[model samples]
Target: DTAVSQTPKYLVTQMGNDKSIKCEQNLGHDTMYWYKQDSKKFLKIMFSYNNKELIINETVPNRFSPKSPDKAHLNLHINSLELGDSAVYFCASSRGQGNTGELFFGEGSRLTVL
Candidate 1:
């Protein structure tokens, strides 16, 4: 089963708390990525990793962290979550960075921090 899967499709919590979401893909692909889609429907690349090496996006905040236990798994941890953090977080995968259109995406983990 070489498909992307993420846990906790929805998460609701108060501001300034800690949360974590998990993602996994059996695609055997070398690269995995995290993307954030805000309320305005803008899809932004967050982080990408290949072979346990982090290829981070400078725009992303340090409060957000990506942990890749292996090639098939990547987990996200958010500390002191803020209200503005509320949005749809997606886990995606590609063979490489030049990865083009329609990346394999998880259903999405919606976090609502109030």
Candidate 2:
């Protein structure tokens, strides 16, 4: 079984549309995160949740929301998507908050806003 999974690997929509990506992990981790990869392949952390509690918010727009129903799931919701928001969103899970250990990442969800 896949340790981490996200739905709708590819999404194509016009600007101003709303979209969401769901993620789940079975690695029995207590922390989950949402990272965005821009066209230049720069990875940036958008949000981080530990045990369903918000921890890190990296100056992300209010339109971007990270919801974690449980320790195993973290879903990303984008409101009024813009062209600049087009990027690959990756979901990851780690053992504990601020742990330097390896992160288990799910296959990214590519969002294209035209």
> Which candidate leads the pack in TM-score?
2
- What is the TM-score of candidate 1? 0.92
Q: Which ranges of candidate 1 are over 4 A from the true structure?
A: 97-102
lDDT of 1 at 73: 91
RMSD, model 2, all Cα superposed? Answer: 0.8
In the range 1-114, model 2's lDDT, one tens digit per residue, is 999999889999999999999999999999898999999999999998999999999999999988999999999999999999999999999997776457999999999999
lDDT per residue, candidate 1, 1-112, as tens digits?
6399999999999999999999999887778889989999898889888866788764878999899989889999999999999999999987755545457998899999
Clashing pairs in 1: none
Q: How much lDDT does candidate 1 score?
A: 0.88
Provide the lDDT at 6 for model 2. Answer: 99
In order, the Cα lDDT scores of the candidates are: 0.88, 0.93
